[model samples]
Target: MILEAVMLQVKEGMESKYEEAFREASKIISSMNGYISHELQRCMEVKGKYLLLVQWETLEDHTVGFRNSNEYQEWKKQLHHFYDPFPIVEHFSRVML
Candidate 1:
């Protein structure tokens, strides 16, 4: 499985709104192909910081299948504007050590 991680910095005074939008946006992501699971976490130290973790069957499932789909546009519409500088997404696999 591939793990997609994103560090999100929400715009000031928009944390609650972001969370509500994310709850709706989650439906869009969870319905995509190769989607396994996802979670959104809030940071204790930072007021506007959040961590988004998603599990996919493969990298393309996210980078291509999801990102390139029409649903992605909806996803962006639902949650993208809440971001300040925009989030950077990265993928990972198990170390298997």
Candidate 2:
């Protein structure tokens, strides 16, 4: 399994808008090939920070497959502007239980 972690900081007073954008884009993401699941987590201490965790069958599913698909373009159009600057994405593979 591959884990894609995206940490984002939204503009003040735009949390609901960002959330709405995510909801709109989630349909495309969830339908992408090799997609497993996705979750959005809100930080308790931070006011505008969110964690987007996506699970895929392999790294290529996210790095290549999703990037090459038309769905990605739509997803990008819907969700790209929600961040202040941009979100940083990282990937990981489980090494232990």
Candidate 3:
């Protein structure tokens, strides 16, 4: 599986709205092809900071499949506005060792 990780820093005072929007946006991501699972975690020490972890069957599932779909536009509409400077997304794979 491929793991997608993102560090999100929301705009000040928009945390609650962002979370609510994320809840709605979750459906979009969850319905994508090859999506395994995902979780969003808030940082205890930093307000408006969140960690997003998503598991996919393959990296292309997220990078190409999802990102290029119509649903991605909806996802972006719901949650993209909340980011302060935009989040950086990275992917990883499990090591056999």
lDDT of 2 by residue, 36-75 (tens): 9999999999999999999999999999999999999999
Worst 10 residues of 3 by lDDT: 88-97
Q: What tens-digit string does per-residue lDDT give for candidate 1 at 1-97?
A: 9999999999999999999999989999999999999999999999999999999999999999999999999999999999988889999999995
lDDT of each: 0.96, 0.93, 0.96
Clashes of each: 0, 0, 0
Q: Which segments of candidate 1 are over 4 A away from where they belong?
A: none
Query: Where does model 3 exceed 4 Å of error?
Result: none
After the best TM-score superposition of candidate 1, give how far the Cα of residue 65 lies from its true spot, in angstroms: 0.4
Q: Residue 24 of model 3: what lDDT?
A: 89
Ranking by lDDT: 1, 3, 2
Which pairs of residues collide in model 1?
A: none
After TM-score superposition, what is the CA distance of residue 19 in candidate 2 from its true location, in Å?
Answer: 0.8
lDDT of 3 at 48: 91
Candidate 2 yields a Cα-based lDDT of 0.93
